[model samples]
Target chain A: MKIAVLSGKGGTGKTLLSVNMAVIGENTTYIDCDVEEPNGHLFLKPKEVIKEKVAVKIPVVDMGLCNGCQKCVEFCKFNALAYINNKLMVFDNICHSCGGCVLVCPEKALTEKDKIIGEVQKGVSQGINVLSGILNIGEASGIPIIDKLLGEEPKNSQKTIIDCPPGSACIVMESIKDADYCVLIAEPTVFGVHNLSMVYELVKLFNKPHSVILNKCLDGKNPAEEFCIENNIKILDKIPFDSELGTLNSNALIAARESPKYKKMFSEIFKKIIEEAQHEAAVNP
Target chain B: MKIAIPVNDKSLENGVCQSFGRAPYFLIHDIESKENTFLNNSAALSRGGAGVKAAQMIADNEVDALLTPRCGDNAAGILKVAKIKLYKTEGDSIEDNIKAFNEGKLSPLMDIHPGLHDHGGR
Candidate 1:
């Protein structure tokens, strides 16, 4: 079963929760889909990393084919192609990798070329297979890297934990596309409730079974908790706002592996998720 | 010499459009003929690369120079290749900018900003 951990914004403990749960779960494969800025490797600290470059197919023009037809330029909705001074000019960043230009070329002047945008690293950490996607700076989109990260993973009996990027954008949707269950990590503040609602709406729109895990719980009123209760969303677990957990996380250490307390905490959350997932399958399937 | 200026309205009485790529209309004024013509900017509604498309439109008109408040790097690159000089507008008035251009008062627009791409999604 693939369990996706995501939030509306950063600093909501997505990496912390996913890394902890992956450490406690048996036969777990942790895949970090946050290509823009992946930090799961810092905590997991995988060994013998194997890096593979990820690329997207972009159109390259061969001006020697002799036709100055503006067909490719007019066909491109992104306006990535332009004909100026009896020559065709292509903008790399503006191109969306749509092969229409190549397909529409009557003279076959346009052909697809690989443009490396990012890399994917695969390694092992404490018996768990850890994979991270790292996008190059200044790249427009990280969807290609996420596609490589999740697309190549084998579908097996192992419990896959997908750590998604922040927000309810296309990247987050791509990360959770194959998830059996989504774990929404939310803080306790009012702003946290707003962010939670965004992912809440996104998961609901995707028709995926999901639950909320409240992070940084304190003594006072928790707005996120209230929002979940009103929405009838399942409350998986609540992690207290403690300095011990913060220190471990800041030190780039997996709290579940270092402390027995965090291990038990994440273990319980993992168990509850398994049970909920099983119930969802039984009911839906 | 012909000059292209992004404008808000078809008339010359209005101010220059603050945005070049998304401007509704472009007023092409010819100094040799002492004539003015307004052409609708088709690149105004482009999903992306509006600046490049707008620059291509201006270049296609055979304009010698572009007078605007600002320009994007992608548009500037296209204009540079097209041999179109970019003169920074002193103010919003189209007539005033045209007069300044005739009098050679406007300076070259050196500060070209990076285009705003994918802002619609954010």
Candidate 2:
């Protein structure tokens, strides 16, 4: 079973819950799809790391081989190409790697070349396989890296935990495309409620079975929890606003690994996730 | 002899559009002829790289210079390659900026924004 954990807003304890669940869940592989700024490796601290570069095809114009038709420039929907000073100027950062420009060029001036956008790191941490996608700075998008990270997973092997990037963009959609169950992490602020609704709508649109994990729970009225209740979304668990966990997390320590209480709590959550996923599959499939 | 200014509307009475890439219309004015033509900015609704597309449109129109409040780096690069000079507008008035350009009163737009990518997402 594959479970994707995501949140609309950043710094909402997505890493905390996912990292802990991966540690406590047996036969699990943790894959971090937050290629822009993946921090799961800092907590996992995997050993014997293996790195693989991920690249995408971008158009390279051969000035000598062509006539100035302006076809490639007009063909690009992203406007990644332009005709300037009687030469075709290709913006590598703006290209979406659709390869339409290359195909549209009748003069054969455009050719594709591999541009390294990011890499995937695979390693083992405490018997759990940890994988992370890291995108190079100044890159347009991280979807390609996320694709590579999730595509390389061993088929039908064991429990896979996907730590998705923040928000309901294309990158997040790509991360949760193959997930059996989705866990939406949310906070207690009004801003948190707004963001939670965004992801909730996204999951519903994708038709993925999902539940909410309310993080940083306080004694007062919790907006995030209220949202889940109003929407009839099940609450998987609630991680309280505690300083012990905060200090450990700030010091780059996994709470589940350092504290037995956290380990026990996460184990129960993992069990609930497994049961929910199984129930969903039996009913839907 | 020909210059361009991003405008909110086709009329010269309207103020200049704050955003060059997403502007609704561009007023191309020929200094020697004193004739003005407002070309609709088709790149206004582009999903991404609107500035680049807009710059390409300006270049294709054969404008010698551009009078605007600001421009993005990608658009600036295209204009630089097209040999189109960028002049910073003095105020929101499109007609005034055009006059300022003819009188050599406008300064070069030195600072180019990094572009607001995914503004509503965060």
Candidate 3:
């Protein structure tokens, strides 16, 4: 089963939970979908097995074309093209590669050229296959790289864990679209609960089975417990607000590895997820 | 000529909108005629960091000038290519700033502050 770990806000222990889960569930394929700031590899320490450049098609105007009509500029929906002194200027950054300008250019001055926006890394860590995409600095779009990473999916059926980016936006949706189950990691805070509801709504819209992993659960009464109970969402696990875990995470170390105490916790969480997925399959079958 | 003033909101008293930061609408108004048209910047409001897109809108609309509180270097460079004059908003009032702009009270702000270099002022 493919499982996607998502959160609406950053720093809610999404990556930590995902990496530990992958380690516990050996032979699993872990995909780090946080292309903007992918930090999964920092903790997982996957050896560089494969690296591929991700490219996007951008329009390149040929000045040699006889006529310099502003039609190409006018037809560009992204405003990537402009006419200066009867010459067409193509802005690579703004181009969405829709080919609308090329279609409208009667003189055939516009042509598409590939531009490298980012790269995807595929590697193995502790027997778990890890794939992550890193968008180049100053690059505006991360969706393209995420798409390229998704395209690297193996044909064989195996348990896959996708560490999705923050927010329930298009990029996150794209990454988690085909997942069999989704695990939303949230903190027990006002902001966390608020954004959790947003992600919950998105998962519901997709009609995917989901559960919550409450990271940094306060020692006192947990507010999210009541909300989760009301919504009929199961609390898979509660990672306590431990300062040791925080320190280990900051030091680029997985908590489960540094402290044997947390291994059982992550193992239990993984077991519960598998059981839940099994139950779902049984009910559907 | 109708000039587009990027604003923080639809209301006239609201602060001028910066291309690099969070803001709502781009108030397009005529300098000589004093007529106003507020084009809701849906892209900027929803997607974040749509300064380049907004500048393209200004160019497509054939705006005379873009009055903003602050702008990033990339957006400023794009506007310059479209031949859109970039003017810094001096006062808070929309009318007052437009009047100041028309009367040549405001000068072209060269060397934008380094803080306004990127989206979210990073």
Task: Classify candidate 2 by CAPRI docking class.
Answer: medium
**Residue pairs of candidate 2 with colliding backbone atoms:** none
Kindly report which residue stretches of model 2 are placed more than 4 angstroms away from their true locations once superposed.
Answer: A155-157, B117-122
- Clash pairs for candidate 3: none
Per-model DockQ: 0.53, 0.51, 0.22
**Model 1: residue A275 alpha-carbon error in angstroms:** 1.3
Regions more than 4 Å wrong, model 3: A63-78, A82-85, A103-107, A155-157, B1-68, B73-75, B82-84, B93-105, B112-122
Give the C-alpha lDDT of model 1. Answer: 0.90
Candidate 3 per-residue lDDT over residues A1-285, each given as its tens digit? 788999889999889988888888867888999988999999999985799999888877788993866787656655566564445656666566667887887888778888998899999897788899997765656789888888787656278889999999888888888888899988888788888888999999998888998989877777666678889988988888988888988999987787788888888998998898788778864
- lDDT value for candidate 2? 0.91
What shift in Å separates residue A193 of candidate 1 from its native position after superposition?
3.1
- TM-score between model 2 and native: 0.95
Backbone clash pairs in model 1 (N, Cα, C under 3 Å; residues 3+ apart or in different chains), count? 0
Angstrom error at residue A157, model 3: 7.0
Highest TM-score among the candidates is held by which one? Answer: 2
lDDT of each: 0.90, 0.91, 0.78
Can you give the lDDT of residue A211 in candidate 2? Answer: 93
